[model samples]
Target chain A: MTHQQIRGVYSAATTPLNADNTPDLGLFTGHCQRLLKEGCHGVALLGTTGEANSFSSAERRQILEAALKSGLSGDQLMPGTGVAAIPETIELTRHALSVGVSRVVMLPPFYYKGVSDDGLFAAYAQIIETIADDRLRVVLYHIPQVSGVPLTLPLIGRLIKAFPHTVVGIKDSAGDFANMQALVTAFPGFSVLAGADPLLLPLIKAGGAGCITATSNLVADSLRIVYDHANDQARAADVEAAQVRINAYRSLSNSYVQIPTIKAMVGLKTGIASWARPRPPLMALSAAEHADLATKFAQLP
Target chain B: MTHQQIRGVYSAATTPLNADNTPDLGLFTGHCQRLLKEGCHGVALLGTTGEANSFSSAERRQILEAALKSGLSGDQLMPGTGVAAIPETIELTRHALSVGVSRVVMLPPFYYKGVSDDGLFAAYAQIIETIADDRLRVVLYHIPQVSGVPLTLPLIGRLIKAFPHTVVGIKDSAGDFANMQALVTAFPGFSVLAGADPLLLPLIKAGGAGCITATSNLVADSLRIVYDHANDQARAADVEAAQVRINAYRSLSNSYVQIPTIKAMVGLKTGIASWARPRPPLMALSAAEHADLATKFAQLP
Candidate 1:
């Protein structure tokens, strides 16, 4: 599909870790259904917010299975399965492809720093060669700030040129619009996704695909409207206003806490569950932080 | 056991990837045996140099099995089992513990940046509590520059105090002597190993433990001698000379290629393998870089 043709808001759903800290399969399915019903084009589970890195391969498979059980097919899901290791990444990606999850968003191996573009190319090359499955559609995940492993413009362009069909798109979560524009300008039809919710309209206007945003976990429907009417001059004010509101909220509390905070807002609004508990090392939001987040979110249009 | 204890040079061996790129188990065992004979304290298999992040759980198990088959016990080996996810970290840590591999170094869940120490504490706390196994001895792998997840002083203090027994030590690859000193001073009995080879004397004089170093992969015997004789002025000078020699060699080439370059040099010296193939996204050293590295090594004492 072309870049413009691939436009639609994608909710990067939060993977609910249970009280005992296992993958809460039941809650995950409910969340997926809610997102789909709210009109999100698809759900990208296991992104940074989904805590994909914190899950085991078996656990990853189980979550993917649970999402499937909820009737979210390959088209409705793009699972995060990339790892620092090649074998594990290939194993997860292959399994994802087998379960009809053709579209996989992969983070580059980010453990080692100062790696060259040549090295990045080698990693992607090895995966495409090993999978050898025509059904697999890889979306290069570019979240350089966190991954420390960047998907540069040249590297993205090279991958697209080498394996046009396999590497169909990219999710630019670098939060840098200049880089996003370069991708949009460089690869005409390649789906260049805006990973930041705030950049949805500008990115779409720059000939890019929709966003797979973290905040969309809370405000997905509004994000969907923003994506659907991205080019509408009449709605530009509303879109810019909403983006500003979300950005303001993110600036206060740790944006890394956005996952649990989004889930907290979801619980407040829809009643799937109460007490949004993020797994430790990442604590549940404090009363003050939550109260603050809720007050600001209450201000959302 | 004590703060004054746990001193020696530990080699983080490289897992030799075969021509087909499958982990060469035989070469792995051969390297381990050679390291043990070289008078090294233990063999740290599947570390960054070993490309721990590049292997599957099954592959990691196989390498561990081969090390055992070649006569290394669990206590004699420290495996790098940290994943970007908690469950995988638990699985690998549990497996290592089950196999009697007690000393498992863990990297923080690194896909997200600016992660609150509370989030990191949550990750480590969950692993320790859930495992509920007494045999587990945790070593925090602090390589912030690589993982983008820094294990801050306060976080370390919290983890040590909370799970005193389970949180055994830390390998500070930050390469900052002051940070290493703070860790040494704070946790009285904690094993604070320096990640940088050159910091051994300063660390040891400061009541630090042994080094979990990459360069030891090439020169374990010399590093061991230096580490053992750190107290003696004459022997310390010899050690300092060797450190200078090794550091000169490392500095000549692109420091980015340190892991593969060191592995290649080891392979060259031992003749057990022809090439040091780091996993994808990390290519082999270029011919010019390789020659420069070789020239610098020849000049080492």
Candidate 2:
């Protein structure tokens, strides 16, 4: 598929771990399949919401295999293949490509803070060179808030110039529309996916691609409505109305830790308690918080 | 070894990478050996200065094994075994223990930001419980500036209370002496190693353990003098004078990226240009910067 085809609502799907903390492959694949069926254009597995950094390389491969075997099409999946180590990133990215998965979102080596643009360029160049896979397509994951490493426009421009086909897209999770607008305006034809749900309508309206957001796991059908109606002059008000409600839902849970709150919402919807348990360093929502969330979610239109 | 013995000047040694960016095990082992022989009480391998996060698990294991095989005692070595993944952390920690290396400095699962103390506790508990080694000892690594995850005093208190024998010490790299003082005063008898060279005298004077500083790679012998004379009333003024000079050197190179600056300094000392090549995320010092550093280093008494 071309870069333009890689658009629309993509769920930053969370990985469901068993009580013992191993990836519940059955649950994970089932969730991805459900997200696809629920109007999500695709499922972005193993992104931050998926706890990608918290799982071993071997475990991540197993997850990909399980999702593929469960009938999820490679065309509808984008796995995060980034890690602090370059070799591991290459291993994950190469494996994804070898299995016919073309598009992968990668974070820069984030351990070092305040790295030079030259260093960041060298990192991407090294990965592209080392992988040596012409078929490999990279969506630069730019979430400086969490990663503490920003992929500045100059670095992105250089990478695109050097490897136009390989570096085709980016997921701008910086939560700043100006940055997203700058990116979308600067690279007209590039696939610029908003990482936040609230930016979906504005970003889509700004000659950009759709979103790959965490809330897509729960609200993909609603987000898809905004994406589908973003450009329709008659439906402009309807799109704005829908986006406001989505933003309200996002704001309601803004007080809680994002990943676990989303997981708890999923658990409430599915009646599966195990879905609520985020791996360590991401605490599960407290009993009181979960009950309150259920009440608030019920109140949402 | 008891927590008390885990003291004095420990170099947060830099990992020497070869021309191809792979860990130079020969050079790495040689560097560790040299640090121990040059007035360092012990060698702290795989800390930030060592670029531990940038190397793969297999590579780190190789480095540890090489150091041990090259006649370095486990008692004189403290490896940074923390990784974003809990299983990977356990594997590395268990490997260190099985090889008779007991004391380890571990960073929290740092990829996730704003994690709760409970969640942080859960992460550590899972690792300690999974490893299930009675001989396991941990020195919590708190460099919130770099890790973006702070190990608050409350969290430390809970961990120590829960795992008194297992959580033995901490290397507070917050760069705030007040925080270090709180840690030292709050937990009397706990090993609190300062992470900066300038804090070595004050930290040691405050009943804290000596430092595990990055600059020790180049100035271990001088740091040893401060550690040795911290309690000497007559030499207290003399120690302060020496510390001012060391602090000045640190300040001169503060404008450059830290890991590469130290790598460049080591290269200048050893006359090996290859030692100056940092991994991808860390750029090497510019020629002008290196020349300036050489001149400043020469001015040191």
Q: Report the number of the highest-lDDT candidate.
A: 2
User: What lDDT tens digits, residue by residue, belong to model 2 across residues A1-301?
Assistant: 2346467789999999998999999989999988988899888999999999999999999998899999988888899999998888989998999888988989998887889999999999999999988788899999999999999999999998999878988999999999889988788678899999999988888878888888877777779889899989998788877787778767765759999988887887788889998999899988899889989988876
Model 1: docking quality category: medium
lDDT of 1 at B91: 85
DockQ of each: 0.77, 0.84
DockQ score for model 2, please?
0.84
Candidate 2 per-residue C-alpha lDDT over B1-301 given as tens digits, one digit per residue, 9 for 90 to 100: 1346467899899988888999888888888888987889889999999999998899888888899999999998899999999989999999999898999999999898888999999999999989988888899999998999999999999998998888988999989999999988888778999999999988888888888998888877778889999899898787877787678767765858888988888888788888888998888988899888888877866
Q: What tens digits encode model 1's per-residue C-alpha lDDT throughout A1-301?
A: 3534355778888877677878888888988898888778999998887877767788889999889988988888999878888888899998888888888889888788879999999998998898998888888899877788878889988998999888888889888999888888888888889888778878878878888887776667777777777788898887777666656544533443666777677666665554376665466777887777677656655
**Candidate 1: DockQ?**
0.77
Clashes of each: 15, 0
lDDT of 1 by residue, B1-301 (tens): 2554345678777778788888888887888888888878998777777888777788888888889888888778999888777877888888888888888888888767777887888888888898998878888889887777789999999998999878888989888899999988888989998887778768887888888887777667767777777788877678777677656544642354777787667766766445567788788887787676667656665
CA deviation > 4 Å runs, candidate 1: A1-5, A233-256, A272-275, B1-5, B234-237, B244-256
What TM-score against the true fold does each predicted structure earn?
0.94, 0.97
